[model samples]
Target: MRLLHTMLRVGDLDRSIAFYTDILGMKLLRRQDYPEGRFTLAFVGYQPESEGAVLELTHNWDTASYELGNGYGHIALGVPDAYAACEAIRAAGGKVVREAGPMKHGTTVIAFVDDPDGYKIELIQRD
Candidate 1:
């Protein structure tokens, strides 16, 4: 079966949305609020959800922060140029935790950036 989407619980929905959509150059595919569940979900990605996997940002009405426990790792995105992507992310007020460089023990260039909710996103350069 094909993979669907990755869900991340964000403390600030708006901030997270901006980070994914504005800073990372992703599109907000859809968003919905569940009043009864007291939560909201927003899907974002580079392409349509039907075409590829996307990211789901979940925001609970009562929760303002998350610990992001140890088990959670970073999400990875393929880019044309890791260096350029990192530079653009930094110019857009995004946090670049790791500078663009070749992966350890490998030649694949990569970089890391943190979202508004402190979620790490890995950028891998692709030919």
Candidate 2:
């Protein structure tokens, strides 16, 4: 079976949406509010859900933050140029946690950025 989507609990739905859509250049594929659950889910991605995996941003109406315990790692995205992507993300008001460069003990170029909820996103240069 194919992978589906990764869910991230965000404190502010609008802020998270802007970070994924505006800062990361992803599209808001679909979104729905669960009134009974007091939560909302928004899916964002580079392509349609039928074509590729996407990110699901879930916002609980009463929760304003998450601890993001140490057990969690970062999400990775393939890019044409890690350096250029970092630059663009920085210019767009995104926080670049690490600058683009050769990875430690390896040659693959990579960089890291943080989302509104302090989740790390790794950008790896593929080609």
Where is model 1 more than 4 Å wrong at Cα?
none
Residue-level lDDT tens digits of model 2 in 1-43? 9989999999999999999999999999999999999999999
My TM-score estimates for the predictions, one after another, are 0.97, 0.98
**9-125: candidate 1 lDDT, tens digit per residue:** 999999999999999999999999999999999999999988999999999999999999999999999999999999999999999999999999999999999999888999999
Each prediction's Cα lDDT score?
Answer: 0.95, 0.97
Candidate 1, residue 45: Cα displacement in angstroms equals 0.8
For model 1, what is the alpha-carbon lDDT of residue 105?
Answer: 94
Best-performing candidate as measured by TM-score: 2
